[model samples]
Target: MSRPQQVLASYRSLLRATRIAFDGDHRVFMAARQQVRQGYETGRTELTSEPEHYDEIDKRLEHASGVALLLRSNIVQGQLMHRKANEEPLSTGDHGIASQSDESVYKLRIHKHTELGDNDAVKGGKTSLAGTAKKIKWSNIDE
Candidate 1:
């Protein structure tokens, strides 16, 4: 089993690291400290001889450190650095009217649509609006 002194040292180290990284927030510092203490306390009665247990904790610490570093860098610049090239040109085509042809063209140049269309006027006769229209009276329905 790992020595009690080693366990206590690790618990304090974890708290210190977390507290420093999140010093600006009072709540975060206290929460991190409490969490570290609770974690060590939970395993206080159990043995710490397993290599995997310590390995998992080490990985968690490394991840937390990485996150802190990234946040610090972001706060300093006020913007995140993307992995891709800056201002990369995207593939785009010039705006133009579309046509149903299989061939591709920048512009479709048809002067007229068809021989007859909606603009040709009503074929039957002139339509009446106000003279033939009737006003509807609303009625209440019983529930």
Candidate 2:
């Protein structure tokens, strides 16, 4: 391939990755907003003074907080990958799309888990933060 083609491919990959990252960020923002709304509605005294409602609101806030953190991390990682791909020279046959795919996968995984946690929160169930924290601590043990 020609130099122009390589540059164009890299640019295209970067644009695609940016789009996916933005979409993920938008979803996270929307989810957090929705959780806030739900929390406000459920926690209000106008609604019956049900303990379950308060618990649900708390869970929603917790789940939203977790998802927001994950999304922020994913966005930073995506930007780093994008910068690395753009600044570094690519060898022949090194399609820039691979980095985009990795970022997209990371975003998608976060989205999936966020949705799952949101659903569980709606049902007044616990989220995976406990497990996630354990994994994080375990991974950090050597550091």
Candidate 3:
């Protein structure tokens, strides 16, 4: 595809990814869309002014593609669920941080493209170099 076509495709992909990632959060969705628009506008001006720098344009395009992929696969939002009065509150951690059970329950907005895995990790839940996390018990959101 031509450079212009590639740029348009990248812009569309970024918008679509943001839409998927921030479905229920209007503020976040608008912010992400605005950022994407600004970035593309800046890139467009640069590319038009310096058509000789094909390498820079390609790098920017690659970065845009990566951002879209990250949005689709990694961005997950959560909605707070009402707390039940009957349930006992869990103990707070040493730093006074409330446990997940003690806090309001959250229903995660996990889309089909969101990454899924177990909670096992080498340290602090960081995934291994192989890029696979421990198995996590989660159900996907049906859109």
Candidate 4:
């Protein structure tokens, strides 16, 4: 594909990633969109002006693609919980929006893009700080 096409694809990927990452958070979504646009707009001239800068342009494109992947896979939105877990469960309104009477807990929005890893490392129970507690010095005041 041509360089221009590649650049456009990168821009679209970033926008879509941000949408997925910040679905309900309008402020953050707009901010991220602005940043992506600004980054591309600022670099457009320098990327096309010099032939030697093709390498730089390629690097930027790769970086943008990586950012999109990271956002899509690692980022997650959270739902606000108003009441305690022990309390009654929240009621979904007619519009399907949960009321935010309080700001205590957040329920993570896990989707297919969210990366899930095995618990092998956690189950291993290996510890480098095993003897850390024994290193503390205790002095008696009676002395």
Candidate with top TM-score is 3
TM-score, prediction 4: 0.70
Worst 10 residues of 2 by lDDT: 134-143
Q: Order the candidate numbers by TM-score, best to worst.
A: 3, 4, 1, 2
RMSD of 1: 28.4
Candidate 1 residue lDDT tens string, 1-143: 34445555555566655544444457766886777667666665443557756765555545545544443322211111233344433222232123322333233211111111232234545452223322322132100
- Of the candidates shown, which would achieve the greatest lDDT relative to the real structure? 3
C-alpha displacement of 108 in model 3, angstroms? 0.8
Model 3 pairs in collision? 117-136, 118-134, 118-135, 118-136
Give the better candidate number (1 or 3) by lDDT: 3
> Which candidate, 1 or 4, has the higher lDDT?
4
Alpha-carbon local distance difference test for all models = 0.42, 0.39, 0.74, 0.72
Tens-place lDDT digits, model 2, residues 1-143: 64335434434443444344345457754664555455545545444436655555455445545544554334432322332433544222221112334223221222222222235444666644343321222221110
| Rank by lDDT (best first) | 3, 4, 1, 2
For residue 47, model 1's alpha carbon misses the true position, in angstroms, by 2.6
Colliding residue pairs in candidate 4: none
Model 3: worst 10 consecutive residues (lDDT sum)? 90-99
- Candidate 4, after superposition: displacement of residue 28 in Å? 0.2
